[model samples]
Target: MPFVKTTWRNSISFKVLLAYVAGVGLSILLIALGAFALITSRSDILLTTDVAERTHELAGKLLFDAAGRPTGFDDSEGDRVWTFKSLGEEIGYRVLDSQANVALASTDQAFWSPVAKAAPSEQGHFKFEREGIPMYAATAPVEHNGATWYLQFAVSERLMELLHQGFAWPFMGAGIVLFSLVLLFVFGACAYFTLGYALKPLREVSESAATISPRSLHSRLESKNVPWEVAPLVRSFNSALERLEQGYRVQQEFLATAAHELKTPLALIRAQIELMAPDKGRDSLLDDVAHMTRQVQQLLLLAETSEAHNYSFAVVDVGEVAQQAAAYLQRMADAACVGIVVAGPADTQTPWQADRSALFTLLKNLLENAIQHAPAGTQVRVEFTTSRLTVRDWGPGVGQAQLPQIFTRFWRGAHRRDHGAGLGLTICQEIARAHGWTLVAQREEPGLSFCLSRHHAGPG
Candidate 1:
């Protein structure tokens, strides 16, 4: 699987504001359409009703004169017309007296013919298109003289057009203004909705940061919840974190590789030094020089993997570690005819928390010390118990007086006074300290007993 850094995904938030605005706009549209339709319908109905009522009243007034005589209306007829002379102004009408006729003709002859066409004998008002012009007219029958007179009345198209022109555009303009004001409210509502989702991106950021862990270093915050305005910041932060993690990993790999590469050259240098001739009459001075050179090389190795060096720690079992070190020195032990034996349980659960190289070196140095001191054919018994590993060799045992100083750096003992460098136990002690353990030398009748204990595990 391609490695994905989980850190960014775990730490980043993604969000959208447009969805909320769309929803808000839709709701406003629905409500506005519903209200607009209902209000306009009611307005049209009321206006039409008022106009119809006025038309009927005008018909009543013209049919009865001031003398209460039905001047142009017939008591019995299918249609009638009534023209009233009011304030010296002409009003047009039609009549039916057993036949269609102009019972009343207003002074304005231009409007008379159209009004004269109204039929009083018509049971109800009739409307129809003529001359491509609309007309409004009403027909009624009423008695004008003692003899029956029928009358009809009509209105031309101009008044209706004037009504809409004079009223509707201005009303519609006002309505549009009202709608715009409402839209302002709607926009704010939509903005609030957008803001809610937009802010959710910030929440995602907080949640992602909360979940950040070493294993999730590569994952980025989701772009979905990140606001476009803030996305740059989140992306930049993720990029920076990625670079830092890469730098630390590179440093660690370089240190591990460098330490491994340097060991061979160091070992070759120690071997070359060991082949040098003695200064003579110095009492095992050649052996001491070779041993000290080896000790210096071992110290270099120890320092390379030290915390002072860039070392990573991991867990290791003491027994397995002792066996591995014994294996590394097996050839030297065989050449010396020093029998190296390791004895413990099949496995022990006790483990050391330490740098792997340091652990290996600690065990190897102890094993090498046993092999160095023991005589040919002598047995170096390595023992492992629940909490300690003990290496015993049948060599000249350390004197009790010098035991305390054995682990001090460069403390050469009286027994090997002219034969060995003094840093072996000191390096071992440093390794033990690094692992939070202890190293001690117990003087035995024939050899030294080196014991390391797991630290701080005593029970009350």
Candidate 2:
């Protein structure tokens, strides 16, 4: 339930759904309140109208009796009779002569109480509580047989209270509940469908964008049939893609040109140095040329693998690749006094479609980095599976702070090793990314482990 509440608070669709439901409920409540007010006002008007009519009738009865005319009573025969017996049981009344003395009453006992002890209201109406019973009361003056009389009447509010509590209040309460539930259900459903419909174009844009690679930069977002609010963003994104494609093309041309221009002079220099007399200085010059040549080769490899350059995919055995990389780099590891060990399924021939050259580069760089950092006589272990490979070495592991930046281009840590441009792990990351694989580095207890996995994709 907490998770659901959190989701409702966080999610846009749920927020919209709740907002609509709340708005509908508020509107229904306002309408119900207005209806209740109107009904109560009309009930008050009917009660007051009844009071005025009874006051007029009482005055006429008194005037007729005083004029010695028939009042539907035989007062001369000593039997006092009452009129207006048809009044409700909840109703009570009193009559006062000119002196404010009680001359007649509808009930056997007095129910109407004066508003004040010294001076009572001559004509008006008000609500009051009498003996814990709520009543609506009124007082009015009338002329009868050349004198004045005052009539005070009251109606018990108990029946009206019961009527509202038993029926009206419950009906209103049920109405509000029913309205809230139906509003939530019906509006929530409609909003869900409406939001899906509204967001359909954005989903399409995402799917189309996912398919666009560095190779397919010519692809642009389709603005037609999309929402007006998102159309400008699509156009801007397509424009940015065009600029990036131009930059990529220029970079690829420069790398190709640079490699061709530098390789010829570098080869000639190395060839000329080999013909000189063998000496320490001469050997050092040759070593420098060899290093420069290796750097140039790595630069070209980095350029090719970094972008959407075509890669060859074929059925290659994982164990065989690990064995080959270990064998090729064995001499260097030996010179560094670091041992190499390949461990995996014995004689396993699980062939997978992959760019063999790219995989070799990835493996070679990892091995080279591991061997360079491992302590003397410490073994570097390379493990292989059908879908994963891990290379681990027993050297001081990378700093926790520097782990995230290890794969960044041209990034080097404060450690001791051979001097070379820091493109090894960067190239490895690019190759992995190009093949839709994940290459992650983790700090081992004594060293570091680089794992390459999810190697399951066809030629792109």
Q: What does each candidate score in C-alpha RMSD?
A: 18.4, 11.6
The regions of model 1 sitting more than 4 angstroms off are 1-295, 305-309, 347-350, 414-419, 456-460
Best by TM-score: 2
Per-prediction TM-score to the true structure, in the order listed: 0.36, 0.63
Q: Count residue pairs with overlapping backbones in model 2.
A: 0
Write model 2 residue lDDT over 1-460, tens digit each, in one string. Answer: 1433455577666778778878887888787787677456647665566556654554445533655332332344223233235544566667666566766677654355524432224456666666777777676776655666666667667755555667877797788778777777887788889998987998899799888876677788888878999999988999998999899889987986797689999999999999999999999998899888877887888888866656877778877887889999999998988999999887668565679988888899999989888999899999877778899998998899999999887786555378666789988988887878889999999999999886446351
lDDT of 1 by residue, 1-460 (tens): 4766665335322123345446656766776676566444544343344445545554565555776544543354323333244411322454456465454544444554444443456535544333455555455555555645555444444444455556764586577667766665676677666666767778789698666543346567676668789888888878877897687657645655665666676567656655766545343554554665565565565455443334457766767777888889999899888888989887455565667777778788788888887878888888876667788888887777777887776677554423555677777876676556778888888787788776654210
Decoy 1 TM-score against native = 0.36
RMSD of candidate 2 to the truth, in angstroms, is 11.6
lDDT at 451, model 1: 85
Give lDDT per model, in order. 0.62, 0.76
What would the C-alpha RMSD of candidate 1 be, to one decimal place? 18.4
